[model samples]
Target: MSGRDFTERDIHMALDGELPGEDRAGYEAWLAANPDMQARRTRYAGDAEALRSAFAGVLDEPVPARLTRAALGEKPVVVERRRPRWWLAAAAALLLAVGGAGGYVAASLGGGSHDDSAQDQLAEEAIAAHVVYAAEKRHAVEVPASDLDHMETWLSNRIGMKLVAPNLSDDGFQLVGGRLLPAGGHRAAMLLYEDAEGNRISLFVTTEPAAHGKGIYAQSGEGPRAVYWLDKGYGCAVVGSLPDNRLSEVAKRAYEQLIAGMIS
Candidate 1:
């Protein structure tokens, strides 16, 4: 904590309250000198709050009988035992929530759209949009599929990330159109696509700078299977009723095209 400049490691330590008393003052001083990092600190604070809210109810849920039996081990039960599976799941969710400073998935293990974190909310919104629009007889999208170029250019500007409407024709799907939605207190883009059978899928993209580090993650919610990933300062999820394997394949192809565009 002396001589060398404060590192991101130090900031994380200070935020987590793991910094020692001797080093704490120095870290705080460093943070005070750098206004830009205040945003990062704020995010950490918000992540802590979100984690608390998401997991608070787990304590009150009834413990599974199997878990209680495991703890009791044939002994006559005296006090109530906790659910082993639930504890493990809660621990994982906590790790997800704080691990990325709240930009990544902190999804509820239950089949619900109320997880309330950035990535969780994005995936939920994506699935919700897809379900609502996919059933449309008409007016499935705000922008028509014919205006692919304008949709790409306009959305790229509004969301502050380069956009590409990945063509899914090889997989028997084509772009239907896209629209803007709200995510993480900012604008997110939702692109819809359809196959010959009229089965629809949606791609939701948002600005999430501190999302999952260096890889993609997939989650199945109540409605659809969503494969999500963060790349080049943005996060996106592909939501559909396709089998998990098929969804993964589509997500992989879309991811490749996006990365290629970024590289080019």
Candidate 2:
């Protein structure tokens, strides 16, 4: 298949060395000519390395008491007083996998279909939240641009993560405002931006999963295609009624700026 025809799944399989011989050759040829794909591959490889570093040690350790009890179908005698460090390490690995690539292929391979479904649900919910809030007239955001600092601080605290407003003026989109919305079990910050044409795009940010599963880039009842990405430790979804290419362009611009601002 041509590079343009490759699905996110194809890319993931290719990266994980699971593609068949011919498909693997095609992907390699495509990568040879596609710098963006190459960069994505590099990032995916880096995420794999991070995962190995974070959790490879856990494989050698005795299974945690809670895990052993759960595996044995026996209720633990005493409630585990503390969460195991392995869980935290695994979470970190998940964050890197989602943020860098798309999501964890290994997790999905291990029968974490629920996680994949959750990501799709997240995209849908984010789009619905965008449609509901972007139409507001008097109060689109909880804190207006006048209280930018307060808005950022309030959102950061509520989301349990720092927040940075993305600059979209160069692309003719101005920050209208932002508000907190419920997403998956965490509070997500939805920032609205509008262009001169009155077209609105919502940037949904949450710290729950960097990437949960393969995200959908599609047009649906909620609105136009939404481009989602995980950067640092945040899950970012950009939704608008714009065309797919336009939405991708805007998402890429926003992603670069947000990553730069947040990382630096």
Cα deviation of 77, candidate 2, in Å = 23
Candidate 2 per-residue lDDT, tens place, 93-118, comes to: 44344444433222332434334344
Clash tally, candidates in order: 0, 0
For candidate 2, the 10 contiguous residues with the lowest summed lDDT are: 100-109
Where is model 1 poorest over a 10-residue stretch in terms of lDDT?
Answer: 75-84
Compared with the true structure, the alpha-carbon lDDT of candidate 2 equals 0.69
List residue ranges in candidate 1 displaced over 4 A.
1-116, 213-222
The per-residue C-alpha lDDT of model 1 at residue 15 equals 69
Whole-model alpha-carbon lDDT for candidate 1 = 0.68
